[model samples]
Target chain A: MSDVTGGGSGADDAADSDDAAGADFDGAQRTGDVPTLSATDVEAGYDQHQVLHGITFESRDGVTCIFGPNGSGKSTFLKTMNGIVPVWDGTITYGDVDLTDEKPEDIVTHGIATLPQGGGIFASLSVEENLNVGAFTVDDADAIAERKAEVLEVFPALEDKLDQKARELSGGQQMMVSLGRAMMTGADTFLLDEPSAGLAPRLVDDAFGLIERLVDRGAQVILIEQNVRAALRLADYVYILAEGEVQFHGPPEDLSEEDELMELYLGL
Target chain B: MVDIGLFTQIVINGLLLGGIYVTIGVGFSLAFGVLEVVDFAVGEYVMVGAFMGAVLAPLFGAEGVFVIPIVLVVFFAVGALIQPLIHHVTTGDRPHPLLMGLVFTFGLATFLRGSVLTIFGPNSQDVPSSLLTGGIEVPGLGTFPVVRTVTAVFGVTGLAVFMYYLYRTRGGMAIRAIAEDRTNARLMGININRYQSIAYGAYAALTGSAGVFIGMTFNASPGMGLQYTAFAFFMVVLAGMGYLPGVIVAGIVLGLTQSFTAVYISGNAVLLVLFAIIYVVLLVSPAGILGKGEWAT
Candidate 1:
């Protein structure tokens, strides 16, 4: 290990491809090297039936990738991160803050932006409009313009499609816009659910490249993806989930290679 | 098969009547568009505005023309408040908001109507008008009611302003975008609840204006809501809920059809014949003549 789980100065860390875990928090207050995200015995469900039964997990820093089959409560877990789903028996805390009870809108203001699975762009709105709308927390007009320009720089494909309706774009382009929309908020943590879903093989590669760029830019990425091999290669740490429980959590190298982990969960 | 002047009168009246229909239809459509539920009590809300105008016109010495803004402001608040309450009561994991909204608003409507009956009495109250009394004389055509002409102008102007706000203003764009796709809009940080309130407010303004016109043209009574409710509902679904321009046309066509039917057929048979024509039209164009299918999607 390259100490990918640490936090540091964030300047040089952002410049370098290394984890630079301590560098992300080197400024004034020494609030520990790794950021804390905890779900303490959470039981979430619909009206009557509980889908998530007392689930608990903790992530220090860097990308914490969650892998599971379709019905293993993966989407529900992601929704709970931003308070989309109510916690039945557990609490989610970021540092000292109790985020388990906050509203979804309030969660976004706290630097946690959720890029929901599928193309979450406003289908009828233009690409520029969609991106601008995403900057809902940014109040100052000048700041909004600056962020819009900056995001466009990061994703050049969105630049030319500014005036085009989001629904008119291809699935991959829509995903790019979705990322651009989320990037507008300057979120420190990303709760991405299956960014590669429904994307063609070529677009998936491009989208993965974009994700790498995001991780390189000093944002902590939490990806919940089905593509086990790709996720293992990209993620510093991995958590394997089955039947609404965490069966394994550690460095990707610790897992018995890609095929072994697949056979354990997929029964292939 | 009738006098040319009478035919012309029917046509003009139909057009003017259509303007009022457009105003009411727009309110109904906007409420449904934003909230995914029809304010079934909207008919009563219109009645409330009409009664408000009826009561205030006598006190302020203001006619129908001036009472619009006051009625609009009052009803806008009413719309905003009522929408959230409906959302609170019936919004949690309900499959059919339309059905729940209808049931809830219908109860509200009944309560409002009973309140009006108890306070204002069953007898109809008159709303005096001065601004739209005289007719505008054209060269060949006979004089048209000044009120009817102005209402038509209000109809077109209201739609123009509404459409502009929906496309041009930041707030308006947010509303339409949210209406089209709520989850995506939420991801963009558009406050769903706030924009929904604004949409309800706009609905109130439209229906409030219709109420004012109703008061100016006819007497206000507890039963007035029922009279307009059926027609307003027909126009909304007939024009297709999402088609703004189509709603306007549908309103006008509905008015004209009613007027012509009343002229050629028996007064008692007018509604029956008009509804028949509407059913035929709906059958021919399931999405309403100019309406699109994407609105439902």
Candidate 2:
């Protein structure tokens, strides 16, 4: 498992380390200021229908996997954090900044990157252009190149296929592009919703492997997934949501022990 | 006996006529491609631009060419201003966002046409450019009318510039990303509204400038916009919806068909012939003439 470096600068000095392929992620590793996101009693929905009702949440040490059934409001909760969906009531704070009213573009600057279901790569864009888009907030050309270089090291297969349109890539390769695009932002925390949703059975493990790599690097991740056991393997904390509310929140071991909750919500 | 010179001239006219369509198609395609708005006001934009050329040409010593720059700026600003309105009606959990956009732009088109007709009446107004009058005579090819040649040049040049901007720049990447998935684009820290505005503004600026050149080529009149509007639609459909490179080919096909049909068939049958081709293309390859465009939704 490689430690994927996260945060601080668009151009993290991954080049400074001798083994950039495994260890160095753009920014210099730090002791603190990891910027844990805390959401309190968050309520949101589309139009008049309410999906989430006062669900308070926080990131765990490494990966916090949110497991839910379809229409469970897990995806909507992720969107609220990313600002794709607005929070009707309740406060979301990233370290000290209030993210409740912040726009999606603004949320990215705060170093929280969300990858919507199916990796969210712009299908028509070339792999290279999709990577370039990751650093959309960065102005300096050198930073973009450096961040891309760092991402390429992680998903080295993408280097050869940079010029090809993203849709042309295989399932696993598209996930790499999607992950690689997100990495371009220097995000300290990743909000991924259903990263494995559309992937083939053979590629499902590979999708979780990619997420594991983000966690191995020290980035805080809040993942929403339907794959119960696959997500549990990577989860430091587990959240089970049923009908837009948290049915359970604790260690993954505890989640398994709650036979009734697991059987009812996760269909375990 | 068939006059070879006349035939050659018709061929040249058709190709040049295609160039004019290229200008309108590129902008219309961009608006549809980037913003997903089937802007009904595209033709009115051209009409207004020609009227601007007509009204402003005299102040610039009746050189219609001088108004291109000013029209580009005015139209760009107007377009930028209008883009938010389009974005407003088309975004969020709205039912039939595409239809909403079409209807809004349709109303806008009607308003613009009515205003121009009321102000200018039904009279055809000349946008005189002494510099563009006369013909450049080639020894054997044909006499290329200077105005048509320049108009063609303007159209092709605008297409090239748009091509370069869309494919080679960061701003281009932003808009393309927005076109692909608006929510994800916002996640990438791309301000969706700003890029949409820029895309629409550039489209308006180019389309409006084409009007000035068109007015110089023919006479600008209140009733002239509908024909060009139909031609613009034909270009996009034939070019492949949202496919940029396909525009030139679509334009040439439409132009040559119009020129040849008007001469060999009937001046009245030109519209009928173009419609027939469009119908066939739609039935066969809804993706576009080259079968490379996004399937028209």
Give the DockQ (C-alpha) for candidate 1. 0.43
| Model 1 lDDT per residue over A112-161, tens place | 77888885777878898888777776665654665677677777778789
Model 1 — interface RMS deviation?
1.8
Per-residue alpha-carbon lDDT of model 2 for A146-220, expressed as tens digits? 778888888999989999999899989999999988888878889998888889999999888888888777678
Chain B TM-score by candidate, in order shown: 0.92, 0.96
Identify the candidate with maximal lDDT. Answer: 2
Candidate 2 ranges with C-alpha deviation above 4 Å: A1-23, A27-32
- Give lDDT tens digits, candidate 1, residues B1-297: 679988888898888878888878877787677777766677787788788888888888877567888877877787788778877765788877678888888898899899999999898887778766888887677778887777778777877787788778788877877777666566556777888888888888878777777777766787888767777777876787666667877788888977788778765676687578668867777677674634443
Query: Among these predicted structures, which one has the highest TM-score?
Result: 2
Candidate lDDT values, in order:
0.75, 0.86
TM-score of chain A of 2: 0.90
Q: What TM-score do all the candidates reach, one by one?
A: 0.87, 0.95
Interface RMSD of each: 1.8, 0.8
lDDT of 2: 0.86
